[model samples]
Target: MPTALAIAAFSPSVLLDVATTVRAADLRDWDIRTVPATSSPQVFGDLADGAVDAALTSPDNVLLYAGPADNPLGRMLDLVVPVTVDRGLDLSLWARPGLGALVDLDAPVLAVDVTASGYALAAFALLAQRGWTRDRLNVVSLGATPKRRAALIAGACDLTILNAGNELLAHAQGATRIASVDELGPYLGSVLCRSAHLDGERAGGVAAVGQALTATASEILAGEHDDLVTASAQRLLGLAPALADAYLTVLRSPAAGLVGDGRADPAAVRTLVDLRGASDLRRGVDVLSAAGIH
Candidate 1:
């Protein structure tokens, strides 16, 4: 019988590379399951409770939950990131249709997964660049990217940050891209993580999964799987041909895409830390090193 592995993430859209990785890693015997998450806290909570075997989440989340930070869970959980998934998914800030300039919206509502999540922090940093402070905007915690994107399209929220094909879907609905996370410097979008308390066998399974993902990323960067990626983007993400091609382009980008070798870059982790303004958390712990990133 196959060992079951449940991987939780915010987005329901599947990545083609993940399927390819499973095959390449000979994990055919592993019953890999993708669980959709409504919020970051829920994902981490499940991870901490051993309800989920692994998670695709942000590095900042690893920092916040792994130690005594003011996380929504209100307690420390021993978590670790084994592999970085993507650079930033081309994460960008967007405005509802006809929202006008960034400076024109009066107390516009900003939707986010959570107040302190990495994407939200990036949105705040980008808005600050345009002289918009957090106090000036009506920030709402809407849970996940898809929820935020829905709220943006329905005019429930005036602005939000979106990516991982959510931005493309929002753009198709007439949303306007206002700013890119690239403005924030080096950034990591997602990581494959699990509780640090896993037993020997499960821990080895997680490591193998990470290696498989890294191999898939390497193949993607090497231009060995363009057609498969494009098709998967279309089928899984519901992106149009042009948009799917664009998604592929983003995936192949060295600056803001896949981590290729699975190792989390120290500079990217530093950017995440700086964006969150939790420099004190870095005092005793090198998050990158702790996450198995050299």
Candidate 2:
């Protein structure tokens, strides 16, 4: 057996399919390890602590690992290739049916997947658009998409940002989408990467992995993956067959978006940095240049 490689992922339709396909494939020196951690910190911790050889992560997190602020492990991680240029990873600001727009959310508490995650990114982006600051809301860290949805339905949150199947289910339960985060521009969701320390020796292997992911993307886009996609959704997310079908409907739809080349778009990076107002995420970056993504 080759080295066991752990790939962190979410429960979205596309990702579920990707994970299944990746696991089924017989890749060299890589006994596909699937680590199911949804938040940025948890994923990063696994990656930094050497628990995972590589992972599927966000572009923003890549930049943060390369940045110099509080991270003692800065510049140690690197993105080997991007899974896609666009994603269904849009954030939905949902409120109860009778509640007003996102602007009218007066609930005592708001929930996000994490303080520094896609949910927060989407929430803050929308708030900036509405001229509201973080201080205006009682923000709570709610773990993952499913948890956020549960909080919303239980009335534990006045508003919540949800993605993947949760957003669709929430809508069915009368949660109205008042605002969207994907519209904010350049929200790159998942990625495949190799650590900087191994890049020199494992470049070829990493590239091969990217090619495999591209193949998986093509297979799904060709519509030959309906069964695989649905099965994976049911396996990974525990979603009902009907709900899994709905999630796949959206994933294969134009709105789900896909980028098969595995290269991050520089424009996407700039947009994320600008949106977060944390341009310093790339303060001392130099390796991104070698990847030709910057």
Q: Which candidate gets the maximum TM-score versus the true structure?
A: 1
lDDT per residue (tens digit) for residues 97-189 in model 1: 878876666898999999978888999999999899989999999998888998999999999999998899999999999999988888889
lDDT of 1 at 232: 79
Which 10 residues in a row give candidate 1 its minimum summed lDDT? 13-22
RMSD of each: 2.0, 3.7
Q: Per-residue lDDT for 147-200 in model 2, tens only?
A: 778878877887787766777778878888868766777555556655655444
Please tell me which predicted candidate would have the highest lDDT against the true structure.
Answer: 1
Show where candidate 2 strays beyond 4 Å. Answer: 12-25, 71-82, 96-108, 198-208, 253-255, 283-294
TM-score of each: 0.94, 0.80
Candidate lDDT scores, in order, read 0.80, 0.62
Report model 2's TM-score to 2 decimal places.
0.80
Candidate 1 wrong stretches, greater than 4 Å: 13-25, 283-287, 290-294
